[model samples]
Target: MSVINKMLQDLEQRQPAQVTASNNSKVPAAASRRSPMYIGMVLLLLLVLLVGFWFSKNQQLQAEPANATNPDAAVRAEPRQPAPKQSEQHSTDQAAPAAIIAALDTTNTAANALSESTTASAVAAPAENAAVNLAAIITAEPAKPTEPTAPAPLVVVAAEEAALSAVARPQASVDKQPLSVAARQHNMQLRANASEAAGDTSAAIVIWQQIVALQPAEAEGYLNLARLWLKQQQIVTASQVLLQARQNGVVNAEINMQLAQLAVRQGQWQQALEFLSDQFELAAEPEYFGFKATVLQQLEQHAAALGWYQRLQQLQPEQGRWSLGAAVASEQLGQPLQAHQYYLHAWQYRQALSVSSHNFIQQRLKATEP
Candidate 1:
């Protein structure tokens, strides 16, 4: 039939839907009275008719091979404008959008034909040929000279290490390592001693830690291991090492003192004070009193902290204004008179320093201020 006749038939078919909507009571009465509304409806009917005619024309149009015209440019049908929401999203997510849609629409029916192939014979020919042709074409095209992937080097596991893993490992027992393990450990200790003689504390530390790992029962290993960890500023690890040393019946007060020092550094006042209680004074070190005062203050033994500070002042009058710390601590401990006296003593020490020391004193004085 003629194009105009086909368009009119399609338009007549769609007119029933518009007629149904117009007859619905929910549509305003004023809609029926408006000429523009009828005109708009007619225009919509015309547009649909035009689309139907264009579709019919396209169906009748001659088909050709894709590569016939411009070999690189695939021949495709003109695309219709997308519906509003689809158009908005498509515009945002695409550039050169019309061409993409055109290409897609043109490929649609060929893809549809492949999906519509129902017969077993039809399926076998296309599916097998398509896959095989793709692979063959790829293989026949060219070989690219890609960089060779290097073979991984084989790892050679030593016999002793292999045998160790082959046996079921038991839980590490505390107190004593096996004698053979101790011999191996003694080798490392001697190695570290030699490395230290060679002036390599870093290498000595690594060797010592390895020895501790292999034979944790040796008290000397634990002690030296703790010392190495302490030098590394790993306070908690050092404390744990010394605790394990105690399990080995380590009787040295110095080891406990080191553990206490690490504990106090981490503000564990109870642990620090407990360790210190068992300690004997080998010499009257000023730092021992200072550390004792620190532990007392942290443990809320403020009066004790102040007394230690006062003892420090009496023993060393030449020392910087430690009386400031005493004043603050005593005041916080509710000794107002003692606080006033210590603050005055702090002031007396302040006048004795030079310009550089004067600034230092000013800072300490500010700290002592009420």
Candidate 2:
């Protein structure tokens, strides 16, 4: 019982101490909050007063110019001489009242003052933002003349006029041939190559046509133009180019080969056969021979195809395609004995044949064996 009474006494003593301590802390906190509120209100009032003062000053400044009763005094007050040397220093000196009035009477001082005031007021903003705002205000300021400078010299004016006249007239005296025909051809070829590299096939085609027109006797230009036409799948246009090239007497083996390939693309086997026949000796390549044999077989000219297949076989004896081609041609020509002999040779040299082709040749051999 004694211990519990002592404990109650201790609790009573600590409660008064805690209450006094809490009250002391609350007093300072309340005072601190009130002080900040008072400071904020005072700052707001100061801002309001500053804004009103600025507005009233601006109005006074504006009215002072209009209310001038004596026009002569206003004229006398204005500086007649243009001070071009002072323009750079005017921005800094414009803060002074006398300098502001003096510069305003002669130049744009009010805008500079406004810009300066805005930059000063925006000090609390970020440095970059402040700089940007200042730049914007300066840019918005009106551009004023530095001075009424002297007029241009007569010699300068004459030179400018002469230059303009020279430009207006064609410069025939600069060079008799600014660009030779050969130079123009080279430039056109470069443009064509650039267009092709950029995948602009139509542009390449147009440039190639220009090259052909520039050099009708140049077989390479005609051949290039024809290839561009073929790339666009314009088979008729390609064929027309070939005919034009032939009429122009631009005889070239490459041009003939291009025509043959173009005719094959258009499925004009007879035209292809004619083109190949003209250039066959010069272009006796294995691919050309195979191409010729295919075209001849498409036209059902088995006898001509048989000769091409024979030539291909001579060129590439181990290739099964030539043997197969010769076998098919002999069968079409109604010579079974020769057909059977060629088919047997094809079976022996059938390394390049696909599985389906192997099956086909086996079936053909069985049919022709009797």
Candidate 3:
């Protein structure tokens, strides 16, 4: 029995060994079945990873051109990896593609923003250059000259007349050609005379000065200017105007007569005689003979005075002044008979004489009776 128990123990040990082998073989078959599932899971994980990598590559390819222009875009385009958890590997695998897609979207957005900024800068650069060029062109051009404004009318005209007078004074002697007075000057002269008639001496003086400035070589303007000046008691200014007239080659009989009259007023007999000398053509004028006769009588040259008076009487037969002048000079030269004949001739026109002269002539006629 002991021997049988030993064999049985041996069989039990054999049985345990067979069971161990079966369990080991079954474990292998089950492992084989689970292996395909793990393989499939691994293949799916690999596919997901490949797709994520492809999307990352695609996003990189798209971002390359933008990164070339903007270096900051390259930094923004790099993919970021999250820290993986051992328990959440499947969950991590599923989220990887989504993250990759999100990164691609971010990279695309950055590239688009970079491209838009570059375009804006390009457009703004040209606009700024155009503005700068316009400013430079405006700066390089020459400035236009402004036209001179006209001066005021009346005051400036008066100043111009004064300047013309000053300039014309030195040239008066050399310019002998008589300047023709314009019709405008003549019209101005008429206005001046009208002002004088209206008792506006100041206005008349201003107009006459303008007329003289217009026609410096004309004797009439100088004469009128002198007359107005003398009327204002400006004797020196009147004399200066007459001298200026002579300097302008105005040696006419009227100018000489006015100068002689002025000299006579100043009690300058020699100067007056020299002004009315024979150098001037004074023969045809009856007044010239009369003035010379009076000047000769003042010098006590009774014979010369008598000759001039007789010549004046022949020229004006019925005038009482000529007859009376001849009578005075003849009586001074001691010819009583000729004097009596002249006194009777003057008595016929006694109404022309003043009251004192008529009384003197009546007494002389009674005294020198024939």
Going through the candidates in the order shown, the clash numbers are 0, 0, 0
Candidate-wise lDDT, in order: 0.59, 0.67, 0.68
Instruction: Show the colliding residue pairs in model 3.
Output: none
What is the C-alpha lDDT profile of model 2 across 251-351, one tens digit per residue? 66677767888777777777777887545462346676687778889888899889989877877788888988999999898887788888888889888
TM-score of 3: 0.48
**Which model, 2 or 3, shows the larger lDDT?**
3
What digit string (tens of lDDT, one per residue) describes model 1 on residues 1-370?
Answer: 3533544454465556646876875666764455344335334434543444454334323212222333332222222222473456335324322222232223335333423432343455356445544543343334334566543322344555666655535433443565786577777778999987897878988898787677655567777877777667777787888887787666666666677788767767798888765254424556666767777887888888888788788777655456766876887887767776776676677655467755544564556455
Q: Give a tens-digit lDDT track for model 3, residues 286-351.
A: 777678778788878889889988977877768777888999999999998899889888878777
Estimate the TM-score of every prediction.
Answer: 0.36, 0.45, 0.48
Highest-scoring model, TM-score: 3
> Which portions of model 3 show Cα errors greater than 4 Å?
1-181, 279-284
Candidate 1 wrongly placed segments (more than 4 Å): 1-202, 206-224, 231-236, 248-254, 265-267, 344-370
**What's the CA error at residue 268 for candidate 3, in Å?**
1.7
Rank order (by TM-score, best first): 3, 2, 1
Clashing pairs in 1: none
lDDT-based ranking: 3, 2, 1
